[model samples]
Target: MNQVVASAPGKLYIAGEYAVVEPGHPAILVAVDQFLTVKVSHSETVGTIHSSHYSNIPLQWRRENGKMIVDERENPFHYLLAAIDYTERYVKECKKELSIYHLGVESELDSSSGLKYGLGSSAAVTVATVRALLKYYDLDITDDLVFKLSVLAHLSVKSNGSFGDIAAATYTGWLAYSSFDREWVREKLNTHSITALIELDWPAFMVEQLSPPEELKLLIGWTGSPASTTSLVDQVRAKREAKEENYQFFLQESKSCVEKMIRAFRDKDLSAIQKEIRQNRLLLKNMSESTRVPIETSALQTLCDFAEQYNGAAKSSGAGGGDCGIALFDRKASLLDLVSKWEEHDITLLPLQVYTRS
Candidate 1:
């Protein structure tokens, strides 16, 4: 049997975290070299799904009257199952016959101990599955369509995510992204056909490619603590509901800061980029203080402090609390100084590079 393989890279946020949760707010992100790969092949009878990240034994399922039926309790494959079901629906919408398939996944986004690195694994896996299946079934695949399909499947499983990770996985590179109004998409999903939905213009959704300054060097460090982005976002949202004015202030300020950063990237100005990084870090700090959500854990603070002490600009990479922090410095700077300081605090330097589909 012939199998088609496809992969999607993970991502890290450079700036605009909590604010990006709101519709139309911009954030900077980059795709990392780590990837989740999916392999899809034809199956005449029972469809089997296997994942290196989820289970040692392969999960089995079959279609019933064209609907996928798997144990709902097998939560580890929830995202994968959702991706398959939605992609099949899209195939059926295109007047194609549904067929059984064996799908398997291999992932490098997590450590051997299964510790997540906050590298957007869910989005990467979903994208990889969709891409592999689309190729296996001989369908036309575009980055935008793959992104929309991935977003649709992801939203079906979890509704609150900004889906910026989906965009980052779909378009592998540095990006300035503004989230689409998910509420609008959710309302439309109930009434529109999947084909029509994919074709419609999503309001406030924008993805622009960016080029980093040649002199800029990015550094990533893991604090050896995993953070739940979903939970952190929920906590921040719960707290911010009571302080609407302050939340709005944060959103506006983040928008301005990210826009300037985007311009700096476009202009290839390393100094301006570092300045905006510093400003964005302060904005996140203020937001965390007001919301009482520890966006920056003590370990992450140490990581950033060491970077700053070594003449670099730094901040937490994602929803913070734990996971990883990122720093940027001029290529001419001595990284050994910051490395030694980070070592004193048990911070592990991650050897990750920007991933682009050349």
Candidate 2:
């Protein structure tokens, strides 16, 4: 009997987000402090994995709307089948069969706020699944191929994604990936290289010593309004089609801003970093669609107003309108002062992290 324990973390894009959705858009993503872990061990049965956390979740191979259906709710049997099929394929490829297995998933992050920051929980699951399956079957899977397969599995789960999450989770460090058409390239950087980048991962790219830790803070203001990502992405696409020139201008400017941001990181220029963040957010605010919800209700306007008051910068995280928005402060700003000001609101101020993933 063999078993494997594997985990994949969530990712955050400090710069590129909506632009990544456009064709040929290059972006960088860092695996963040969140993740889902899956453990697979050999068991007696050929089918059926007992999943304790989620409801009747199953993975299967079948036809849905004329397409191969990999999973559907209540498909525990399907997950077992998927594990067997994947394991058998790996074994055959390796010219060996290590036998049957049992698998369970435990993603550390909670949905307590039901807040799906949309960092790739499913992609993390896919990464863990393939790794556990291959390890259990006694085969070596390359990280590149693992990433490719993970992306395929992700598309199988949801077709609209750009694969940013898969890229960040598969590789153990910060990644510079073009998610739109799946163009990926990675640069290894030790935590010292970008004092802001911190984590418990490989540090083989730059300076050997780590930068002194600084207390990072974020002031999050919730508008209590949320919107649909599908509709928002569609809206952006529509606007771009109608106003190609203006949109292209923003794209070029945003790309320049991102490049400068990368340089600011390398130079340790905090002011430059803040400048780029503000510039990029401005371009996105005017060019992109409304935060999916009208700014009035979405708190998009309110957050904007607050950012001005605090002398900081703010930007929406996900498809917009609601969910969460990130408010980046100048490194010298007082975190406690910001917190005291925000204490009366329902908003949550989370400790911020800038890290190269492992």
Candidate 3:
């Protein structure tokens, strides 16, 4: 039996959360060491998806009339199914076919106790599944193809997303990314099929490689609570649509702060990076207030305050009602002291680092 295995890393947003959804606004993201893995093996009769994280019972699926059908009751692998469907569509567009297979999907992106760490698990799983299926069929898969398929599959499931996580999973390192035009995507979705969307000239979505300074120390602390990113993003989007002026101001300020941080990264200016981190945190706080969305929870605020006392910078990494907050410090700063402070606040330190693709 032919088998193929592939994995993709989860992501953390360093800067530009709500604002990055706007077309052309840039956000910095880092792919973390944690990854979701997918294994594909040839199946003689039927397709099945097995995940230890979800259950012992394997979910059966089949492709009929060029569409995927799966048992939807208590199904937890919709993203995987969606990815496979999208990849199959792409392959069909290229005048090809994918063989029947049994897929095993799993992840190490969550806490030991099964709490989600707000690390782009769905995006990583989608990317990994797409890569595994393409490799299993001996199809040539480029990074651009992986990204587009992953985004298409994700959008089919959620309908609204920025896809920074998809970019991070595909690129597999630190990246400075500009948002693709959401309006353009919606229009294309209305008029085109998934295969046709892949062939279209995508709008100005840009991603650039970036590196943190050598003297910088990165730490992630889990707040033991999960935030509903979809709910938070939807609330903010509705508010922005209603009050354009306030959201526009937030976007401009966030863009400015992100630009400063990028410049600091290019110049290797630690002080400037620290300053921008603080400014970005404040901008998010103001945005939370204006949108009436709890982007930063009390626990995250306390985490930032503790980091500030040690002259380090900290903020909620993603949509930020709760989950994980990242802290940045100089090499000379005492990690022991900071960890102790976090422990006192009952926050758990997540031992994660940036992952680079080989």
Off by over 4 Å in 3: 189-196, 199-201
What does candidate 2's lDDT look like per residue over 254-275, in tens digits?
6678767667655656666667
Task: List lDDT for all candidates, in order.
Answer: 0.91, 0.55, 0.86
TM-score: model 2 vs. ground truth: 0.72
The TM-score that candidate 1 achieves is 0.98
Q: Output the better candidate (2/3) by TM-score.
A: 3
Candidate 1 residues 1-358, lDDT tens each?
A: 5989999999999998988888899999999999999998889989889997988888888889988778777657878888987888899998888888889999999988999999999999999999998898889999988999999998899757788898899998999999998889999999998889999999999999899988989999999999999999999889998898999999999999999999999999989999999999999999999999998999999999999998899999989999999999999998897898898899999999999888
lDDT of 3: 0.86
Judged by TM-score relative to the true structure, which candidate is superior, 1 or 2?
A: 1
Q: Would you list the rank order by lDDT, best first?
A: 1, 3, 2
Best by TM-score: 1
Q: Write the per-residue lDDT of candidate 3 for residues 129-199, one digit (tens) a residue.
A: 99998888778988888998988887778746678989999997878987787678778978998667776
RMSD of each: 1.0, 8.6, 1.7
Q: After superposition, how far is residue 312 of candidate 2 from its true place, in Å?
A: 3.1
Model 1 weakest lDDT span, ten residues long: 67-76
Clashes of 3: 0
Sort by TM-score, best first: 1, 3, 2
Root-mean-square deviation of Cα positions for candidate 2 versus the true structure, in angstroms: 8.6
